[model samples]
Target chain A: MTEFIPPATRWHTLPSPFAMKRGGELRDARMAYETWGTLNAARDNAVLIVTGLSPDAHAASNEGNPEPGWWDAMVGPGKPIDTDRWFVICVNSLGSCKGSTGPASVNPATGTRYGLAFPELSVEDGANAAFEVVKSLGVDTLACLVGNSMGGMVALAYLLLHPDSARAHINISGSARALPFSIAIRSLQREAIRLDPNWNHGDYDDDTQYPEAGMRMARKLGVITYRSALEWDGRFGRVRLDSDRREDEEPFGLEFEVESYLEGHARRFVRHFDPNCYLYLSRSMDWFDLAEYGDGDVEAGLRRIRVDRALAIGVKTDILFPLQQQEEVADGLRAAGADTEFLPLPSPQGHDAFLVDIARFGPAVRNFLSSL
Target chain B: MTEFIPPATRWHTLPSPFAMKRGGELRDARMAYETWGTLNAARDNAVLIVTGLSPDAHAASNEGNPEPGWWDAMVGPGKPIDTDRWFVICVNSLGSCKGSTGPASVNPATGTRYGLAFPELSVEDGANAAFEVVKSLGVDTLACLVGNSMGGMVALAYLLLHPDSARAHINISGSARALPFSIAIRSLQREAIRLDPNWNHGDYDDDTQYPEAGMRMARKLGVITYRSALEWDGRFGRVRLDSDRREDEEPFGLEFEVESYLEGHARRFVRHFDPNCYLYLSRSMDWFDLAEYGDGDVEAGLRRIRVDRALAIGVKTDILFPLQQQEEVADGLRAAGADTEFLPLPSPQGHDAFLVDIARFGPAVRNFLSSL
Candidate 1:
């Protein structure tokens, strides 16, 4: 159990004895965040960005860290986010290992890693933590709140739980609730990790007994769903790996170029993300259902959100968070009387289009924020 | 490594020192098949049914086996194929655990299970073996060749390698070659099995060291892709399992009904199928490329097949073998001057629609065979 903190990360100590949504309390917890540009004197220029599952608070290169962040192409000074005009803040979700208080973080009282002892996580808890970060910064109301993937669920929760928290919202490929198909995929991922001998019920050490194979499998599955088959056909097709790149001795090893690509991609990710933290955060997403707030109606729950203006963007090819989900969020917000725009872009990259396909997403995001 | 043979399965010995496509030979090897009807006097009424990876040769109930088989609904008397009118023969794929000479079968010389020692299998190899059985049965291919899923690829190979083997073909939810998306998925499945500690590089015993966890994960992945998200949403939705059904002690245990369904489904499959056989059969599909026969052009390869008529059927919601792949198969066959009917069925069962969505699949298959 370990936390991978980026160089540009900053911390905000949460209120003492902060109660979790799922019935547990953290005595001395903290949130990890990073900022870009200057806050206006009126403090109305603050734009908070809640991230997907694995992204760190370091969304882009800052003064402290020159290395490019996950969304560097979209979050730079003059990028789609346009940090030069609006003060931008990105926070690592609560249960993530990227410099945030998570299973990888140590319990202050016991001075040991929380691991499986961490409270059952919920998307609401992450929303509340992000809310605390906003309040601590002395921002009464955010000018605009942006969320991508899992963050979309958290942002929805934040708006529902804390009325008038933000004047506007932009949800990118996020859903109002966890659908059975998505839940099944995430459940399989968690099962893969748990089945690993090295996982050892989340008691394994980071250095000696890391669940590398399980993590690799989970990451490969994620990669497969993240992109569309259309893109795969256009890119790798049925191309085979070169003889030199082939593992001849290993019978079931990489043969297709697509297999090799997944292997390389999964290997790069397995060690960087902590297994326990990944499990906690992933389960949190699976448990998220805005319908709970609406007496079991997802649209009704979204209607409860009080954002003045909103934009929900999704890719046509996305399987994990399909286009219909974003439409649901847009429809719900619109039904609540918020001026909303639902844009389903034709990006072959699928669920990961928001991160990789900047040509289409850049203008859509920039236009939304410019309007805000 | 023990093979699970069904009661009705009969054997046909391959020629001695049977050579594999990818440079290896099997001595005293045999294929397992079951017949539903007697061969007519002219021997032109034979309809050979090839299968997907896991199914046995017993595709329907008969005098020898009272048990209903995998495709019982569509293969029995007065059904889709109408066993009474057509001498229906279903052969267990060569590399499957279902009574076929696979990795689970014993090596004649070594006197032990072949496991990894089994020659690298190919869709073409299975096709050739099926051809041998057809020849041994004293049939001069006159009716139709029916293939579903992996069998579709094998059938295509069978047609390509053995010219004029069958007069007509009905390919259900199959591709001319392996696509990258399907390759990625099968790669992850094989990786899951390989990662299991008990798998021990395909040397594990049936009882104690069986790769239950690995096979469970693999089968779950298979099940997820076999059906559509639309079907899952309609069937399970967000229904959570009862507390009694969930393992509360296991943090990452089953939560949703979809998860529970998958767990049970996978458990039922893991023990019945051998892991090494699965690896071989799955890889065989990934290795199949119709383009290899025609200077890297799939359409050109399909043109070489001399079927008099062909039908390519696909479900719209199938992600593993998407509707487009079947369209490709149909288009290529049409170019080859065959009277082809490319029926893209609107079934929500995904890749496995042919197996479960009989209401839609039954008629399409019946019409195709009747026309033949």
Candidate 2:
């Protein structure tokens, strides 16, 4: 087995052009990932951490970047997904601008940005790419595969697409399929970008940030839906964002504290994320449906997932992937004769509870993996 | 009292330029109203029905417009409002475009469309304008005042601004104040309009619809949030809008029935509504705070509402004005010493339940008015 030395940042280019499951192909396809801790001699002590649509492979800070990772609280030397024991690899999703081959990448055919020419992407493709990453890392059998949000869906897709490839799987705040409600939300985000006159049919160039306004609005809706209104009301009930404004007066700037918070976060997101990449990734999410695995029978799809054990964790307040969807995952797996543990965590952050309230969400994940 | 004759459609201009309570004025301020049934010899028998945003005086079909009104299912000769027994008056809100003097009207000062030049608006201004319409009609006392959505907020404002003018008040899907959540939703809607390059700062005119795309996107979001996901899942459930497309493929045109539904409605709205009017009325809603009546005290706002009896009906699944806000209305009324009835109706229609599933939401209104 290869000596296990955790790498802070690494890139792997597929030997050949990567073909997509749905349609199209990515030439010069590359994968970016970050790892923590040391891999054991057995090559079995590896855990794959897949991310949501926006997060990069930098899930936790390392020597390369001293800054904390997105899941800094949950992944550390001694915390859940402990690096001291298992090698953890978080890979930037395919079709994402964050250090991965995406729409922003140059097309090998025309030597221009892919833009709208990017092929239809599916969660299965992301899953397959992740498997390639694992293989390149010399890990034959993963100790556990952990996914959150879009990552979770990809993890589930990996199980069904490559049956028996994983030892176990853990899906957090994810559903077997993207329900119509979610599809509608994602569709609006894409429409926001496409409708912008500045978007120029996604061929915006000259280093100009096209359709920033539309993207900002899209992120605003995203942030609002990410957290429950209960949390917003509790944290900011009509509290003014800027104290200098007259109490009864309305201004062009933001009024409520919540609006300011949403704007600030969206602004940051807009600066780092590319619009075309966002469109492709979002549409891929909407297209992801595991039922295709079982030929329309969800139970059959679950049966195809050959793992020693699996776990599905849901948050009660997660409207995106509600508890019922998570429950359906467990029920399907149990019906398929798989040893599955279903845990429901109550949180105020809605679909974002996994990332925000890690304290409450982590223990369930830690315990389930520990049990295995 | 004037003779009880239900006129078709009529317009009444205020004796003077109508000044807004918050600031700004409408030149040649006029209100359009349609009445049904016969006003009893005692003017006290008139019941005023104020409409939500985008609707006109055509609450129900009349001779001028033979088609069914937007609320045809809920109001008619023998419908819940029971036009046969009581004189029903539905008025176009102050800043709407259907018939009333609004942003679409020529500004007497500039001889141009008011557009953004129109003064800041408030729900109180809408209420006061409606009061003027009632006075011009020679109705001294009203049997009941019913308002839905933005109209509901105006009804509450009317009860307080013109204390005791309405004998009984009914607020459906309306709150004493716009919550932070609703404010955020409205803010995004306004941003959609403002961000549209074609919007031209709301100055586009001369028989052209300005910023139609932005309005369409805004309506898309509006339709999504106005109903419960459960309803969409039950009714549409990823059903293809066009079956000719490949089962696994995505199309540029709408693919899901829900998307088609929202687009159809938004298309119609775009054709009929003015963008500036939408901005004005939506901002008016955001600015309205019944607590302003009680000096920033919500309960005091309820107390300032000098009504003998009141009713607040909420949809169990309404996300726009959640049941909790509806409950607050009832609780405040009770604390204010009013004989109030709170009806928590269950429906999958959410905030639009009153307009969509009349069969389920009408009885509460009917029974309450009948009891009064």
Candidate 3:
């Protein structure tokens, strides 16, 4: 069945235009994506991979680059995703700072950075953009759509809006709607960025730093919430960072091991990610409500997802989206008369389980894909 | 046996030099405290109450002010504390700025605010100051000592340092040492305050507003931690605040109900609380290690506690100090051969359960006091 295959890495400009869900339009909107393996003649072997808040088009390592992908352990030659057998396409999400058209992109309307002028982005818009990229690559009906965290929500948006587009779906640690606790945590992150005097309402000059302090605080908070306290309790405990720092020297640098851990990730993220893009994407996640699509009914919302097969993977310790949310996905898919599998994996990683729990999550994903 | 009731609101400066645990001494060391009811002729009926991080000497509505105190519901004349029978004394801790000498206090040596130059403070120093206040009030021994959260940690310090100073001890939602999760949270809070450009390394002008924005962010984080996410989920889940606020307006203000709730408390706290004191007290809590007192053994530390009886009350939903920490206290106390009662109660509130869950926590305190 192997036939037309897109280039390893390429861009797809929307055939028509991207009509944003919340009243906006993106003309000449282009989606950046990468492909592995071959698309069958019938285009039925294509597997779409959507990423979480901070990832890009890179998912698994390929011949072009030997460096491992973000999900290299889960999506490689003999990996759970099995690029050898399945054609995989991972798209950098719209409104992202990756090599995609986002707020960082020059606005065709003004020829300058969109800055705060970027239109309101929604999960549906991201899905539509990704769909356009997949269609341009000659993939008709997707063999499987696998998304984790924010990616899971985008997959749902795609499935609900275009009921028969994907053959199967795998949602990992995602919710039908963002929870209040998650929303509050995100609001604080946004506030941290905005409160920085340098942010200037997301209109900072090109010469100066772009609210790095606020971004650092945001990333620090995100790191704390993404992983469970139990994981950190045993790992870092009350251990000091530097034993030879001479404690009596006014103490300004990182003191505890956990602080150093958080700062490391935060500093790295603040350097690469854009603050305006972060604000836009975070609000879009909050604005997502599948129940709204079902006319104020949850069961009806689930019933709209008309996939042939689906898998909902939930982590017991995932505070962002608990097991109940995954259960809702299973219940919803079943209500839509779709064959579904709900896998509940317990791990100390919390919402981050999908990112690194290869042992527990990998086998299940492989089994699901093989069965499909 | 009732006689000689201490003044309702008063200050007591130790006649002799007061020593701190780590080093140095306060030449004019003074403690501010409030009391209710009469002391017995034998001074055996005196009850001491230690406060959490932000509370002051005012525990209930007293003679000086008829208004309700922070714990007015639990410590009234005929309330659970039963001021009618036992002499109740609430002392502001050593590192607190509320009616106590803290970083905001003037250093006699420099004739300026202590600021970062304040001597290193530990839980033991706070306990020593509180004990001195009680001793100066003509009290030979306390009938009981009640503490919650940070206060609970201080109570353990006092009990271990002066074995026979109190007949009974009640520790609510506290641990022998600050856990990693708690330490991480406090670290972020201190970082928030310090990162604020207006903060000037704890040397900000006294005339200007003191890093209120940073303090607000820190307090908001504290409020989130002090209660369970499950509690917020049911109460303020994804609901928009002030529908009147236009959707297109710049969102510098609160948008979610949880944000409003947190911002309200944070704003109130930033006005009254000193940022430097918060930093000092928070670090002091993280530095508290009971094992240090016991020559590096938890059981040996508990064995140093010479109290006749003790009670540890823990809320099941408390994430800051989970049930395991309270269990550790009970286990250690029993290992030390002290008569101890361990009660694990369920509440939606997390660490703040002790402050507001009077219905659940009140009867236990009253019963424990009556039995003692």
Candidate 4:
């Protein structure tokens, strides 16, 4: 059996809400988080790196068998985030399969896994959970809150809900509101999970076979949007899969390097991710809306923010979160009397540029953090 | 039933070798073509507009229903092609269902549909067929041969096979070789058709099902690549299919504009196209490679071309056939001593720009044809 090392961190419990926006209620809610570096006497050097849809507190730190964190390149000792300079904190939000109290967590009332009984999590609720994590960390104010994709949504929510909580915010490859096309793609991914016969209506236990097929399908669909078409074509136009073909046989097959890349991504993702979590998180992303909380006046809502600075970074080829959306975020922040910087990075990686195009992104982020 | 009207002019058949590279023999193969406008006494006023993968002889002249032809904008009485001065001919190439001997055509010996017995066609075969059509039109030489996508591949083939056939050639949004990603996508589409329960190993003629599910899936996949993510996100993001929902109950969900758009496209295509035909055409496209025929010397093959001039047009957002491919075509033609013009049309519609972005494409094509 593999040895399990408990996280060298503390967990924080949040006030239970009866019902969430999408229905269902929580009896006892909690969040998992980890902190790095040290808090200054004024507690002003805190930097919160919010986790994506399924990520946990181990965002900027190493985990299991000396493997580096997802954002290690941007966060480590002398890197962009610079753990040596700032007290970096990451939290596992509600409705996640990590150490947080999610569908996989045991329910106090039922004495069983919450499963589908877990309350649906909105971006605001996720932010609220993170807020509790921050308070527990003994931090009164944060220097910056940096997030990517769904985490960006959470960061935006934090800026809206607790204006004085952070001095700066970085929203990377995220939008103010989910677009209709995104909703459609997310819906399909959710349906792929829900429709899987092996899902057993989300009742499968840890020991049971997970919805691998559904997860694989969802990952495949996600991969399509995560990269640019030019990247796909340039990397792998109509190429043969196998070189040895029987005489008189048609050799036309998925021979392209892009197809193999996409397939590998799907296969690897399915191995670690839960199908139910995929559906829940995708739906939450689709429903995320900053204007909704601000009564539909996006500018007015942003004006209510009390942050000191904002940084919006967009990838040029990211169709999911276009550069225009980032410009809107910067415009909103500037209008709110907050100093804002909008950087559009050129990359062929599309929406996943933040994760893959480290060469270009690392220095920009480092400069931004240093300026802050 | 749809009304069928014969062309005002008579058709002449030109002889071609029926034997394909795949070892199948199509005995007594002939190419049928229609010519519009009068040929000059010297017969040097000939122009050829190669139709797309499925289009037939009716490329640009008015037809029975008084509908302008497929390329009516650039080839009318007083338009760019100038029917008053130049003779234009369009042919139905081999391995197509448009008045051509495709899988659906009856075999002379068996008195039945050729079906899977149809020979696997190559880009060279398509060019050879076009050569026959040009010869049958009684044109000793062509002033120009214009083609798009698959048709562009044929034009390249023509340049390699019959170096002195045309003075100029236009290859729009096409590549000298099929990219690996394109082949993989085509393979998946073919697999969708082949795996359908109703496919009956490509022999389900009597079954009325006609692989609708498989075809619908294939079309959905095709539509995703046919357009760009930017276009889809800008047009359809996450809009719901239904605006009204019953109280206290979730309505049958059909959310997201992209899904609805793809579904509509899939449904409409299924009504007209055969699943088997889709498979055959996709495979043909996947296998197309000018380098394979020119002994893998693309530059040398292009240098052998005797065309006096060439025009290559590429759409900015055409991921399937990007602007770089068109640039390569122009460079090749220029290297061969042909006066070449490379025009990159700006559009967000991706590969479908040629069909939809008429405002931009029309003027460019008009200018080129007028100059010719």
Q: Pick the candidate with the highest TM-score.
A: 1
Q: After superposition, how far is residue A141 of candidate 2 from its true place, in Å?
A: 2.2
Docking class of 4: acceptable
TM-score of each: 0.99, 0.94, 0.94, 0.83
Model 1, stretches more than 4 Å misplaced? none
RMSD of each: 0.9, 4.4, 4.5, 4.9
- Could you say which candidate leads in DockQ? 1
lDDT of 2 by residue, B158-189 (tens): 88788679788788988888777778888788
lDDT of 4: 0.71
- What lDDT does each candidate get? 0.92, 0.80, 0.82, 0.71
Clashing pairs in 1: none
Q: For this target, which candidate reaches the highest lDDT against the unseen true structure?
A: 1
Q: What is the lDDT of residue A249 in candidate 3?
A: 61
Pairs of colliding residues, candidate 2: none
DockQ of each: 0.89, 0.54, 0.58, 0.29
Model 1, span A264-333: residue lDDT tens? 8997898899999999999999999989999999989999999899999999898898899999999999
Question: What are the runs in model 2 whose C-alpha is more than 4 Å off?
Answer: A1-7, A243-253, B1-8, B243-253
lDDT of 2: 0.80
lDDT by residue (B130-150, candidate 1, tens digit) is: 999999998977489999999
